[model samples]
Target: MDKNLIALIKILVKKSYITRTDLEVETNCSKRQITYRLEKINDLVEAKKLPPIEYGNQKEIIIKTETKNFLIEILRKSYNDKFYYFDKRERIIYLYIMLFMNLEYLSLQHFMSSLKVSRSTILNDLKDLKQELAKENIKISNSRSKGYYISGPELDIRGYMMKLVLLSLEDDHNSVVFDSIIDDYHLESFQFSKKTITELANKYKIHFVGDRLDEFIYIFIFLKARLKNHKNLTEEYLGKPNLDIISEMKEYKFTGELLSYYKDTTGFSEQEFHYITAWILAVSVGNFAEETEDKPIISEIVDRIMIRFEVLSGTHYNEGPEIFKQLYSHIRPAYYRLLFRLPIYNPLYPKIKEEYSELFLLVKETMKPLEGLFDGEIPEEEIAYLTMHFASIYSKKRDYEEVVKKNALVVCSNGIGLSAILYNELKEMFTDLNFYLPIDAVKFKDFDKPVDIIFTTEYQLHLIEQNIPIIKINPIINPRERYEIIRQVYTLLDLSVFKQPSLESIMEIIWKYATISNPTQLYSELLSFFSSSFKLKNEKKEKGYRLIDLISEDCMNLGIDAKDWEEAIRISGNSLVRKNKVTQDYVEKVVENLSPYFVITPLVALPHTRPEFGALSYSIGITVLNRPVEFGNNEKPVKYIFFLSSLDNKKHLPAMSDLLHLLNQKSFFEMLDGTKDKKAVLEYIRCYTSQSTISSSTME
Candidate 1:
């Protein structure tokens, strides 16, 4: 088979439906060549007695279920076979792994035998690998004495080795590449290393998220192999405080115990234990981290990253400490991943980049603080994951009066940000089903909660002995998979499916009666209008209140004689209680949450809690203090307090956005402090907000 065509075929097998443009762009082929390839695929399938693939009217590549399954089986089988087809790039990486692991002397015969290629082909691959290594200031040399040894900074060589292993695993999530590697290599320690990793996970109760267990096994199989050859790591990058913290972490103890079990095979050094502990913690989900707020290193890093986000995105967010704590949990693992150059594959990377392009770029730029821990450029995969967290935080809220038809469980083994992103997507797509997301895979099998259906990833439906129906969902789903999920879930639940109104038929009727003044534009507008209308009907939700709806002169107060910050919050929030916009419970929570650090700027502070605590509706009350009170630092006292209450996350963004901008101009603060009249302060704020054209466009 032609290599390019086979590659395209494999992609088609992975993604059942893709647009013609996307296919061409990914394959780097012309339209004419795509047509020829399609014809070639059809011929091959026809020879195999399978249905032919065709392009649908929507430019989607259409194939029958049987044909797709057949292609998948064939591809999987080829990866397992000894005579597996080795492309130029994979063959070179294959050579890298083999060279690193082989104890016996390497020769033309050895390379040819391992790759199942001709001697000349193996020689050419070696020449290419040498050239590529040279770019990293590494050299590959052959000597009769030390056969096929690579010479460079040993650290770079190990980093390259880890990068290759992760890259292979990323491409082949099924672990076929790793299976072949361990089986073919002459490394005697591979199986023992694999066994020790398995024991570590089971004995320590470490839940490696979503195929990460296999990744751990594969990474250490080579790592131990290198260590047995006495290629021990020589450098330590962390400072004393960080080293002390990691050594004190629970994962460090687990690493120590794991090394003890394998002490006969691998030396138990303090450096090796710390190095192993870092990577192990990097991969595990929800490792038992201390709830102590005093971890200054990770906490400071999270605060700095959030500050950067606020600067680059032009949004000020005061989400209490919960958001901070959640971000801290995520960044703790990420710090290690970057520190050790451990590659993470985000399957949702392309989708995140295309959908949240501006947010993604801003996040990438603002993540300079993260590189403080590492010397290398932060990977795009890591950035995209962070973007998802911010996207969830700053997602513009559209109110949908959602009705519950079925209680569905969304089982995603990826961490909180990814699971939250998936849940948001599902919520918009299927308004009828109430999704309780992000239940860990480790917990799903024994879950006692009532669930009508399950949508999961990476795990099969029938493997568990559950009676509830399941539909496997992809994080970055194609059109057909999306359609199948909706259709299957709805059908299983016996819910009435709403048919979309025929826009084309409606257009035909309009064409019969309407004038021909840019029918195309009219049709386009009508299609958009109808889709939005249909979407709204399905969602059945109300929009959130804006700043204008919540803030006015009636809620304004000035020159209040508050004794302290707690008193300031309650005094400013009097109108919210008088109007029944919030209960006393909400006000008390806000008062309790007030700290010197809660002050956004030296001049102003906006205080809030979760919507359910006491908020009955959207409201904002303002108080300009007569004397500055210490809501933040002692030097920077707060003169303004905006007590805000929202029904949910979406309703308060516009209000926050407006308030942030007004506080941005020092003149706004100066005017508020200058005026003792409540009406004057209210009028000035209204005038400033009236000219501002900010919509729900900001993210945290």
Candidate 2:
């Protein structure tokens, strides 16, 4: 159980080989001590029924990877052994929990023995702990009788302890330090309280979003274990809600149910319900469990906050009342945290501050709503959490549409599992065009799919003739590859192809060379000139999509074999061109603009071009594919192509709405997907369109 032997086992577990001399050089163990401890390690591994540590013939320390790890966990968990890895922060936390428990006399030797660190390490930790606690005006007094003791107001001490635990929970690597608290104290009380809270939470349909509930429970148990020393929320350093206000809320009743069982053992007073209620409300999100209307005061604050945020961030919530509802839901918990002086740790605080520095500062400036409501300045951590809500609002205002888009094909080796995962990651990153399911690498050469870029895991793909850009990538792409893959895909695309003549560039050519006094008028005329296509595109969208009005019965083609999305577009548009509703130029224009965005709600393409592009009349062409064609621009493959030729935008909005309604019907898609008869598809659209448009109030 020597720390040195544990350290040696840790080394052996990490490395493939370590010689007797290497072990001595790495560790303080002597040659003889190394010989003896190897026997000890073998005995431990054998006792666990694992393969014994082997000293290889050439003097390498040969240990089974499993056996060495087993010994390390044993030393890690064993109460008798204090051989574990933790940082200075973790050490201070472990020490704080110890002193907070007030379990025994905790001297320097006791600290050294418990933490398995040296005396100097414990001394420095206590120094840092003191400095940290002093900010809250809390003191860690040490006496000869009691080695270390934490003294502060009950609420501050409890909050500080919980804040420490919450900060620890924010870390992904500090589970060892987190788990130590369970081993160190209150095993049964912690378990019982967790089970109780969990059962009640589930029964009430309450939920926790992330690690908030876990941290909340640990802090609760710590406070509950020391109930003999502390009473309910009587600390008057900060203001809390009056009795009538607390009793009026739904949490009061829920608190009664939660604390009724603990009343006898933990001796909960009347005020304790308010204290426990604040804790419960801070973490719970699901169903906002037992949510009632916010108090009038809090409601007004939420309103003011929303308006103030809109002004501060220069963003408008024009969508609906949904954003307001969400803002209130999030701010309710935030209000409780601020009002009760409850500190939370936003794990995203650093990233938010770094990435959203301007938004963070703006949100901080917009905290006037909570100004008179709370006594103290809101914690920066809380502000970061609040900033996220506003940042989402602000981000939604920007048009994130990618100007230059390309079709990316994912080709992976062997099984579809890894390839499927890679496909999803790419889908999330490139939202404008999430590729269809991944294809096999072997098919990459003969693949007739429409692809602008090929992403393959196989290295041999580079040697092949991928007339399209082929990016050879690893099966499991790391962060650098993820970034580089995106960069490479964008680099492969020729942006000039997508870039039209902008007003500014045109003006630069005109104004830079020729001076004009009527610049504003010239700018307007040039903007109108440049926007002719935009006007046509917008105008073309307003056609009434009644059954026979737009969906020409002569145009519906079912189950035709198409090579690619381009071919699919042409087949649908051919009927419209032949009917003189569109020109061949119109068909080609539709092909040029054939993006995945034209794809229907599910597996269909509805490609259209402007009236300026030879849309001679309003008509529709429908073609169904025997096989789905991957557009390389959407999650779904195109099964049916609907070519629309519009001569005007007038009344097109309602028609587009009707079209969306038709597209959403599952039976319509099913009929088209299966029916060989073109009449069946046209008849279904006819019946639905008649039923829908006949109900229009404007008809009255």
Candidate 3:
């Protein structure tokens, strides 16, 4: 049978309905080639005395239940034979599995014999493998006497193995081939059977999803293999601390029982037991075996997190009991995951990081207290989930009516050129503000029908006498003046508005306007109008909040003289304190908590503490050093320091997301290096934020 036909059959069996186009794309073949492969697959199915799959009207290849099952079984039994003539990608996968699973040295001849390929072909595959492994910091160490073997940091190797296993699970087409290799090598052997582990888990009432059971099984099997080969993880590698708290818990007892099964076979050490304890804690087990007495402990932690989040974001979720309950439930499970160093796989990890970066960071900071309990840092995956919980409560508590749009009057003593520039700049900075065209400062007194605030080139006594807030700004609107204007506007404005009208309101309006003779037409028009209006409002709001809107020239330092990371951090943080964004104590607290410094990138560092550590507002201070400074061992050297002082964790997330996006760009450092003037750098940032805001709005 043709290899393409075999691959196509494998796909159709796994998927209920796959488009012909998808098949063409995956196979890198033309539609005509797909048709030929499909015909071959149908012929094979007929020969095997099985019902054939057919292409539906929509050009989706549909496989019946029986046909899929039969094909899966047949493929499983004969996978090795069909795997002989493999493509380049398939060949690489096989090599990956061999290197990952093999305990001893592998020679060029060994691969040649196993693959039944020429020496040059095997050598080329090794070369490709070497390149791929290098990307992950894993290298194939070739010894003239000992043979070829894989070597790298243990963590990196295990991470790559986990990724490979996950890929195999996801790609069902290659799973059979991978399984065959596992079985042939007797690599599936475990000290404790899957049944024994499952029974123990159920006996203790541990809550793990079905898929996670496979993870547990494979983990134990791998552990057994490592023990047999005397490849023990060091005490430092198994850095789980103080399992005494859960010593009396049912889950702990269950883990003990599970370990007992492997004690005789593997000679499990205390370190090994501690390692298993971490895994047990990290897995999604519910309620600490229903210890209702411990509920307060979890609730207390949740309360602290919520309070810190509220302070950082300048928002409150204290009034919501549902929020507390939800957080309490999540934190209990998360506590174990953190304690065990088990990182869950969140599919929304990237999106969450992009959209709610500040909130995510806040959650990470809030959970720092728990790190002492776990004796390790909480993984980003767990932090992402916690961010979602807090975000949910924040969104629910947010009052749309509180975000009222404000009207402003701009007064300029200078010519129309300065006034027009100021008007446009203010409009861009304050998205929620509606500004009247610039009027002469002399006309300021005559104009007032009661505007929320007045922006003038000079503070006027008459405007102040009217009891309206008067903000003084330079006519040219430099970065510092712009930041002050924004701060003043935010302080003066109500910052809340009524929620947008609902569909029901639109329907009622349509009913009121319609003649009753054309109900369908009226409904259509009303729906279109409401949708377009809603879309416009959302776009305007999104484009209004630029990243540069949160930054000011006063808080930005281009050439800071710092001998060490501490000095650099202090310099960056003190800028925020001077601006009253945070207090001196906040800076001190940040420095004190600098043991495990948050190195954002090789060139950048973000040093921050909890919002309640004396942060007065949501602000970020940037400091670029004259030269790079070393933080400590295991930390990257830093030049750019972003000191974040958030009033509330939620509000500054969009700005944080924008910053991350900017930092990810290759030219970000280049642009920073090219400028020492605060205004020039601010302009570059402003332009970037403006472009990003527009692009995101368009995408939405």
Candidate 4:
């Protein structure tokens, strides 16, 4: 059997069914040669006693699975340059088969039509493909109803490509184009006209030759552009071939010998030969297509191809090499027809053989299409924009906060009192400036906004449950430590700064705030000092206990309800007032990546915030639960909640040490869980305060 015939069969088997017409278009050969080749194919098949791969009913001829493996082995040998060198068509045919091995059913007539060829040419090639299959005991059959497909045991197809397809070009091509002859392969090709070409040449103020000079260069440019963008150009039929003859252009010259050499080297048909030679002339001169308008599109193509390949797939000159070749194969003829109308460059400079050679190699590498090759079809401008966008994203290392900033809303009560102060503070702090009101003057319904942060001095119980950052402060006559509050807000929002502080400084602050030894423990007491509700009437008349009575009476006077009080307790008691309280190991685990807190005191735990986080209020929430829960100190589980808070670089040492002394009592903790009365809790606190040694120490 003819080795080429065998190679063709393998291609068909792997590909399932490739139309004979495709072969004709690809080989640039006639129907007679293909048919004669097929008759020779059957004799070889008989000599080997292999089952016939060709079986045609009424509709079409098909290549089957059994024959496919045999053919692939032949391709493997050819691909390795072990046997004869294959032509461009054969190479494309083999690559297509190897690349899309799972292709089963194929429409023979439709495939032939796509190749723009006659039925006889297709039949002859199918004959050759089948004969080769027969030699390998593979069967190729066609049914009037079911069309074409392979049938047999599974074969290790992909493994074959991994071994053969990925083999180095040095091992196969040997740095020469015609060293391999792949006649059996069928690849799509197209062309353009001279009139369009000269138009482009005139517009660009370059030389335009009616000969093979300018045509070759134009094709090269088009191929390079299309390949980079991963775009396919279908032939646009414009009634007649738009041919323009530029008689004045004596700038570039070409010899018949050069044309003959090209024709002999690259197996181009008569028309294609003319087109290729003309394109080469265009390329010879420096009139390559360099449209600024096309740059964005080309760059976009490069970016997209890179992302798809997960590598730098193309260069800036054009999309890349692979796209060029595919275009060369399919659109060369269409290009010829459009050439007359195509605006071209003049005096096709001497062709740069080296440049073309480099381009050819790149095309070969890029031809192996993968899944993500063309998934994102971005506009040229958008792709250019994305370059800057992706750069910013990477430079800033923005994970999710950037998104929140663009969408979040900030709020503070009517821009006057503490709420206003907090509002301006946050507005200056957060880079993405957004906020809302904290006053009852605006209805709760009116407060509906995409709020992410809400800072308020006066607690409006109705607004507590709203979706936003609710930074509540004690209602005060005059808000001190406004700067401190602003700084804390900045840290919380992770504000963008003119000059970013060192990572050490940031981490130090974070660790100090997240740790149990900081001043966040005093939030409530700090709030109490600033709050002006102590002189209220109705609630103090009932409670008897001075502080609680005063607060309750003020709330009743303000028309707040019991439900509001319960909510206040939940929000203030456990959530806000309790500092970096490590209630459990899990809570400690959550903050472990940021800071190491609980190791300061063995039996005592002081929960607090770092001084940098503006502690506007010094408050404490003592939750002496019914049962003592295990805390950092294994020797004595925590019963006291010392909610500490502080201003920058200033820790209230005496108050902290006083609270620590109370917690140092064994009996106080022993009966801590037993007490249920509110009065009893207060009485315990009073007793603790009466003790001596009220100073703080920094010595660990």
* Tens-place lDDT digits, model 3, residues 408-459: 8888653343355456546555556667778866556678555888776544
Model 3: lDDT of residue 517: 78
Model 1 lDDT per residue over 410-459, tens place = 88767777766666767777776777756766677677878988766544
Local distance difference test, each candidate:
0.68, 0.62, 0.62, 0.34
User: Could you tell me which 10 consecutive residues in candidate 1 have the lowest summed lDDT?
Assistant: 456-465
For each candidate in turn, the TM-score is: 0.64, 0.48, 0.53, 0.17
Alpha-carbon error at 562 in model 4, in Å? Answer: 62
**Model 4, range 1-700, lDDT digits (tens) per residue?**
3555754443343222234543443455565765566556556555566554563211123433344334444445544454354443444333334222323345576446434446776566666655644543444566765454333211122112222322222122121211121222221121232343444545545433212222233333333222233222223212222122221122211322233322223333333323333344323222114342223433444444333221111112223454333222222222322242222221111111121222222222222232133232222222222222121111211122333352333333221222333333343334344444343323345755565445543233344335233344322212223323433344545565423332223334555668635333343344344332322222221111111211111111111122221232232234332344223232232223221132123333334433333344434444433333355323344334333333321123234434434545677666555655556656666666555533222110
**How many residue-pair clashes does candidate 4 contain?**
110
Q: Name the top TM-score candidate.
A: 1
Q: Mark the regions of model 1 whose C-alpha exceeds 4 Å error after superposition.
A: 1-72, 99-113, 116-156, 172-174, 188-196, 237-240, 244-250, 256-264, 287-325, 347-354, 357-381, 393-409, 441-498, 501-534, 537-700
Q: List the residue pairs that clash in candidate 2.
A: 539-649, 542-652, 543-652
